[model samples]
Target: MANADDMLKVAAERTGELAAPGMSSRPSRKVAVLACMDVRLDLYAMLGIERGQAHILRNAGGLVTDDVIRSLSASQRLLGTEEVVVIMHEHCGMNGGSDDEFSEALAADGAHPSWRLGAFTDLDATLRAGLERLRTSPELSARDRIRGFVFDPETGSLRDVESD
Candidate 1:
């Protein structure tokens, strides 16, 4: 594979114009999905939605941080999307670590991020925490249908998380 610089150049060279240029900013699914930034997770196939169907907000643990709340507020008020889906997964790297350990690790690299690392003990409980954050967030336009799921990459399926 090419180096990072070459990768961008190669990608640009092979890229084509958008086929759906006139697509609206509003999500077609009327939902916003908060998911882990794990490269293996694909929202399209998991939810069976097409491009421009849903607003996907990805972060390390898919936790509802302040930034996510900010985005979700705008997604509902400005954009035409509603509802929230939190998809955490099995074998997440966020599991089995402490915030202090994560902070110290970053400190060694001369970077001290202020945000919580959101490491957790239980995957299902972590997923539930994210779900509850959306539920309690007053700015979310449609909290009635908030859902959480734990994706099993091994089984290639999702297990529903019971509401808190």
Candidate 2:
């Protein structure tokens, strides 16, 4: 298990020097990727992107929500991002349950979230829905640049998903 002391060491090492300085303030790839906050998934390495290359937004399932829309709205309209890619994966934590049920369980465990959990019964549907959500959000500026994919956790492969 990770400890607070180890985290402080990591932070100290990180702040000691710039990992990849001299890159532009804007992402070099000019893209933003919405991905799940999976421990096994390395967003930059898996996508062949580097630090300062793309903006990555991560959450439980990488499901599009009002908060995501707010961040992306600024990423595009303010930060010069031109592309959006959503990456959902198999065997996700958000699968296999209803949001209401999950919330109830959380409440029992003494944790309560007022926000929507964005749970889904179908992975592919959720993936496509995230793409469409970004495309249709009136707050986002680059609607045409949005797309979605499903990642295979076992094989570390991403399959293109139809965002109809």
Candidate 3:
């Protein structure tokens, strides 16, 4: 059996061959976006961006955690990314509950009653919270631009939450 490194090397060579020559030579556009891992949200299509146009960082609720800060810092300082876009969508699964409630639900068995309460919850508060976290993060340069938007899954419209 091939080792993990050998497998990775094979994959990397295959991916390099598939990449466009311009993408392989140039750094991506100077934008770093944080968005949810929701299947309904299509980042490139929605933002009208093509491949290699931006650096996308996705996670649950696109919450601004420590790893996000580290990545954002590197993107700005090392990769020439000067803009941050936070895209939170409506009908998110990570809304309408405290962190404790979420942790408790995760720890419970498959039949936890609280799990039902967690679905299709209002995501406005969480969206605002994520925006605020980005605004207050010291890792961002003062000149760096940060903006937040809420994508309505029903209407397929994006609403600006805040801008900096």
lDDT of model 2 at position 160: 85
Q: Candidate 2 clashing pairs? A: none
RMSD of each: 2.3, 2.3, 6.3
For all predicted structures, in order, the TM-scores are 0.88, 0.88, 0.72
Q: Give the TM-score (vs. native) of candidate 2.
A: 0.88
RMSD of 2: 2.3
Residue pairs with backbone overlap in model 3: none
Predicted candidate 1 versus true structure: per-residue lDDT over 1-164, tens digit per residue: 65999877877886564346688889987888889998889888988987788999999988889999999999888997778888888878888879998799899999988787888998887777778888898987778888898888788888789933
Candidate 1 stretches with Cα past 4 Å from truth are 1-7, 10-19
Off by over 4 Å in 2: 14-22, 108-112
Per-candidate Cα lDDT values, in order, are: 0.85, 0.85, 0.74
Flag clash pairs in model 1. Answer: none
Candidate 2, residues 1-164: lDDT per residue as tens digits?
85999988888888746555666768888899998898878887888998788899999998898888998989888889989999888989888868898788889999987786788889997787778778788898778878888888899888888834
Task: Give one digit per residue, the lDDT tens place, for model 3 in 1-164.
Answer: 75999988888889866668645322367788899889999999899886666889998777777788888888777777788888888878776546656556666855544322333255666567766777788887633478789998899999887533
